[model samples]
Target: MMMNMFFYMGLVSLIVLTLNSKHLLLMLMSLEFLVVYIYFGLFIMMIYMNYEYYFGMIFLTMSVCEGTLGLSILVSLIRSYGNDYFQSFNILW
Candidate 1:
């Protein structure tokens, strides 16, 4: 089914983000893909199961919050370091 495909794509994107630490942009892209897929899957399930509108609204809210937080974090990270590379995060005391 389409839902299953989206779920698998989200899972794969998460895995790719976890394994590849070189490109922060790629990681962000993967994160966005995962979130979108999750949203799509949830939307499909709600429609198929005849859920209430509140559930869909909640999911949309969550997706918005997630996107905002992720973009903020990415912006901060980029500002701190001139590049969007995961390896640039080095904390030393």
Candidate 2:
């Protein structure tokens, strides 16, 4: 039941992430959704295994740090480039 729902949601987010690769914001959003789905899946596994939640907390902390890092990078890029479009930036510099 819930497992199927999570699987479908993860799949959808992956599709969105793939289809919207040109827009940084959209890619970030879908990646965030995928992270959230994994977090929930971890929560469900912990509940079933009767395990401590310390690992989950650590994972959540890491995920938050990852998101903040990504946002900061995005902000720096937008500040210099004026937009979040990948086509607007160059890698050869």
Q: Name the candidate that leads on lDDT.
A: 2
- TM-score of each model, in listed order: 0.75, 0.93
Q: What is the lDDT of candidate 2?
A: 0.91
Question: lDDT tens string, model 1, 1-93?
Answer: 865776688779889989876987787778878777777777777888998778778877887888788788879888988878777778511
Scored by TM-score, the top model is 2
Write down the TM-score for model 2: 0.93
For each candidate in the order shown, give its overall lDDT on alpha carbons: 0.79, 0.91
Which ten residues in a row are the worst by lDDT in model 2? 84-93
Which segments of model 1 are wrong by more than 4 Å? 1-4
**Poorly placed runs, candidate 2 (over 4 Å):** none
Clashes of each: 0, 0
- What's model 1's lDDT at 84? 81
